[model samples]
Target: MRHAYTVETVRAAERTLMSRLPPGTLMQRAAAGLAAACGSLMHGTYSRRVVVLAGSGDNGGDALYAAARLARRGAGVTAVLLTPDKAHPGGLAALRRAGGRTLPPEPEAADQAIAQAHLILDGIVGIGGRGGLRPQAAHLARTARESRATVVAVDLPSGIDPDTGETPGETVHADATVTFGSYKPGLLIDPAAEHVGALRLIDIGLGPYLPPPELEALQHADVAALLPTPVGETDKYRRGVVGVVAGSERYPGAAVLAVGGALRGGAGAVRYVGPGAEAVIARYPETLVTSGPPSKAGRVQAWVVGPGLGDDRAARQAVAEVLGSDVPVLVDADALRLADRDQIRRRTAATVLTPHAGEAAALLSADRADVESARLAHVKQLAEAYQATVLLKGSTTLIAQRGHPVRVNPTGTAWLSTAGSGDVLSGLTGSLLAAGLTARDAASVGAYLHGLAGRETPVPFGAHELADRIPQVWRSVHPRT
Candidate 1:
């Protein structure tokens, strides 16, 4: 699992590590890593043009010292100091000694350096910076975007909220970010994540000093450990059956896609109940279908409710019956709208709610734009409000449950944004829940597998193709010995 710590946690860890080391030791380590990365970006050190946007903190020192290293190696480096008077004294002196020149934040000199430089290192602000960039820094960011140089941010891109992944104002768009010590939440979550083109973590021995992560993302090995494996004694019932209540006459395709997803999710059998019975049977003849309510849909280890289920009387009845069952339930799509909030909060069994930004916004009574901008905060709030595991899907798929580290899915692609994708996800997650995974585990694992499948599928594909590819991704994660 890849872990992301908050700014406070990172600061605490840095303080602890800094205390044990001699003065300037950590900065030297950081400078070495940053300089090595900058050197690798260039074809050769000789006569290479590099520009550094240095601020007034340790982050500025990191950039300035790195520029000095490059200058000593025959690169012509220049520093554009946003805070000329407050710039790191040691870093400024080092750069001058190594033949690097300093330029004030004058538009002319700064513009000239940015336009002609091969690379630009952003160190205008550190993790403690909140809101947006200052006027000078914002201008540099805009100029850097308009320039031909490859922009590399130090620690993090300037103007991003390190703790919440929120970019309240103008932020630098980097070709890549070289973060020190550990991953920050803003680097992994989006709008800020979108600005961070590529991410590279540099270790400065802060791991042992850091506390538990605020968020985590699972990799192949972690998913492999969590996936359920069938034993010799495991029969169809023992392996688990997932009950799906989805689709309407208006959108029978929702039922078919959801059932397809459940079938691929390691479930021994899938029992589907809804108005789309005939359509589902036509596509997946193996599905056990019923026109009755979910309560009469035979025994199931878990229930998935609300994909294309309209707000009709029967839909409400079906949702109520399923919620009444003493089994885990996954709520999605139109069902998120039709189901009673009180009942959802009152459920005895585990519940997982999957919502895209708009659906999440409706639930929270907030603007969708706000939810999208502050995804980390909204997902956490939704999880706590409903007392259920919540999966907020978008550029970054996040799974949050109260009292646990929020999970960010790193495998998602924007191509997975097609129609009925959420339905397929609901079915797959419900099947995992049936297989005895906790709501949190089920949602995270389902998202991980679904995203991998989406990536594996050819572009411009439909939701059905996405569902078909799940087992392939699953096997890749948990291969036979």
Candidate 2:
């Protein structure tokens, strides 16, 4: 798993590590990594035009010192000080000693220097920064964006919520970010994740001092370790059966897509109970179809409720019956509305709720825009409210549950935003639940695999094709040995 520590935790770790070392040893270590990355970006040190947007803090010191290294190697480096009087004194002196020049934050001077530069290093703000940039800095950041230069953020992109990844105001868009020590929450979550184009993590040795991660993203090995594989004695009955309650007269395709995902997502058998029985049977003849409530759907290890289920009496009854069952349940799409909160919180078995921003907004009684802006906060809130696992799917798919690190899925393509794609995800996650993975693991692993399948599927493909690619991606992760 790739761990993301909160700003407070990271700051604490940095402080602890710095105390053990000499006064400037930690800063020098960070500068060394930043300089190496800047050198590589320029491709060659000689005659390279490098610009550093230096502020007044350690972040600025790191970038300025890095620029000094390039200046020593024959690069013509310039520093555009946002606050000329408050800029890091040591960093400024080092740059001057190495033959680099400095410029005030004048539009004409900075504009000309930035336009001619091959690379720009952003050191305007550090991890504790919130709200947005000051007027002058924001304008300079805009100009930097307009430049042809490759912008590299020293730690994270300035003017972003380092913990929440929310952009309250104008923020610099970095082509690449060289983060030191540990990964910050903003570096992995979206809005800010969008600002951070490509990412590079440079270790300055904070591992021993760091605590538990605030958020995590699963890698292939982590998912593979949690995969439920069949043994020599395992049969179809022993693998696990998933019960799917989805689709309606209005959206029969939801049933077909969900069933497709279940079969391909490692479920031994699928017991489908819904109004789209005929449609599901036509698409997946192997599905065990029944026209009864989920309670009478003949013994399933877990249940996936909702998708295209409308707000009808039958749908409510189905939701209630599923919620009443002893097995774990995954609620999605229309079912998020139909399922009762009290009933969910009362359940002993695990409950996973998957909601897109709009649905999550409805559930939390907040604006869709707010949910989208601070996805990290909203996801955790919903998990606490429901007392169940919550998966907030959007630009970044996040899984949140109490007492565990929030999980952010890193393998998604924007193309996966098409309609019915989430139905496939619901089924896949439900199957993992039946396979006996914890609610957090099921949701995280499901999002991981589903995102990979989205990338694996060809462009302009439908949800059906995305589901079809699941088994292919599954083999890629847990290959036959």
Write the residue-wise lDDT of candidate 2 on 1-481 in tens digits. Answer: 7889988899899899989998988888889999999888879889999999988899999999999999999999999998989999998999999999999999899999999999999999998778889988898789889999999999999998899999999899999999999899999998889999789989999999998899998999999998889899988778899999999999999999999888876779999999899999998899999998787789899999999999999999999999999999999999999999999999999999999999999999999999999999999999999999999999999999999999999998999999999999999999998887999999999999999999999897899998889988999999971
Weakest lDDT window of 10 consecutive positions for candidate 2: 258-267
Candidate 2, residue 178: Cα displacement in angstroms equals 0.6
Q: Please report, in order, the local distance difference test score of every candidate based on alpha carbons.
A: 0.92, 0.92
lDDT of 2 at 377: 97
Give candidate 1's TM-score.
Answer: 0.98
Write candidate 1's Cα lDDT for 246-337 as tens digits: 99999999999999999988878999999899999999999999997787889999999999999899998998888888999999998889
What is model 2's C-alpha RMSD?
1.0
